[model samples]
Target: MSSKREEELLECPICWDSFNIVENVPYILWCGHTLCKTCILSLRWAEVKLPTLPVQLPLFVSCPWCQLLSFRLVWKGNLRFPRKNFFLLWLVESANGNRVRYCPSSSCDHNFVLPSNRSTVSRNGSSSSSEYLHETPRSSPRDRQRTNHSLLGGWRILTLLMNLTAKFPVVIIFMLIVLYVIPASAAILVLYLLITFLFALPSILVLYFSYPILDWLVREIIA
Candidate 1:
């Protein structure tokens, strides 16, 4: 059997859960093999493999079991959705390290880790450099209402501007070209229609889906 397969079959030395996939259990990966997190934790960092943590580390950590450098591990967490109990595959490092990366999928259970460069660049090259960003999550009713209004206002203004900018120019160009190249004009009109349809169809579908959900939320909040 492959070493990875063998590692998967063997029970975690700590939690005694099967490697790789456990029923809502956390496992650490060492040399492409998985072991229980608890087992990995309890072992004196010598018997278990440790993956490279995402953030900067003072030194590199090695797996105790396989004597190889580790990179990824999975573990369960409290945050959950409809059916699946999610797990995090995080990098392991010393006491002072960076947080693990959250999953990128709209609905994801696994939080994976990524690598970091030795030296990072900043505009000022100052240690005091900071980044400020705002992200909205599942929000309150009032917040949602305000955001919806803002988005709608922006969309309306943008559409109006787009129509004004495009309609006259398109019409004049079409008319001008049509005076000479009848077949070319026909082809251009058809292409324009297809392009508009391609873009507008997806938007219509989005509105169709979003409207019902937004309606329900609004009603529930209002009630």
Candidate 2:
């Protein structure tokens, strides 16, 4: 059985829920505190927004314990996801008696499972207390080899493309010159430029309009 302090350490400060490997994974904040992933997602919506500032600006969330503000970059009106605290996750799993073992080989990315009935033996032949190992079935060596080959082939193709681009920069310049020289390609280029400008115009306008308001807000916040 885990101690009271250990149980408290495994619980999220915000939700008061115990951390688990599945839904309640522990995510560490910039302020050196950990919270559940669900609570972090909730914080995104709870962040205070400056009505006068542009909505595209990064959002800030105050830590529940320290009140220290942490800025999260916005992507499509959503805050950037925080990193998971794997160490805390391991501790939680160990406390729950679910011991996860990884493959000893550096080449093998997948985990191999040990039988729950067997005791895990150490290098010195000492037996440790057996725990339930929950892991997916390991891939065969042939499958691993094929996967590695496929990844290597993909990297080779990418390197070939990069080498071609580096060796034949003149070809790219010639293609660009031809595009402008030809009326059809020139019209296509113009249309592409127009589309890009149309897409970027709204953001530009928002920034232009919100500059003054943002300046005032910064001064007020700093003061």
Task: Give the best candidate by lDDT.
Answer: 2
Clashing pairs in 2: none
Over the stretch 1-223, how does candidate 2's per-residue lDDT look in tens digits? 2245566877998779999998898876656567887787777423444777534324566668776555555478543655676667766765555222223354343444555667788999999877676545455667645644654455456446644644475677788688766878779899999999998999899989898999999999999
lDDT of 1 by residue, 121-151 (tens): 6687744434433332343556545544654
- Name the top TM-score candidate: 2
Give residue 31's error in model 1 in angstroms. 1.2
Displacement of residue 173 (Cα, Å) in model 2 is 45
- The alpha-carbon lDDT assigned to residue 111 of candidate 1 equals 34
Per-model TM-score versus the true fold: 0.20, 0.36
Model 1 ranges off by over 4 Å: 1-10, 14-30, 43-60, 71-223
Collision pairs in model 1: 14-39, 46-64, 47-65, 48-64, 49-63, 51-70, 51-71
Model 1 root-mean-square deviation = 34.2
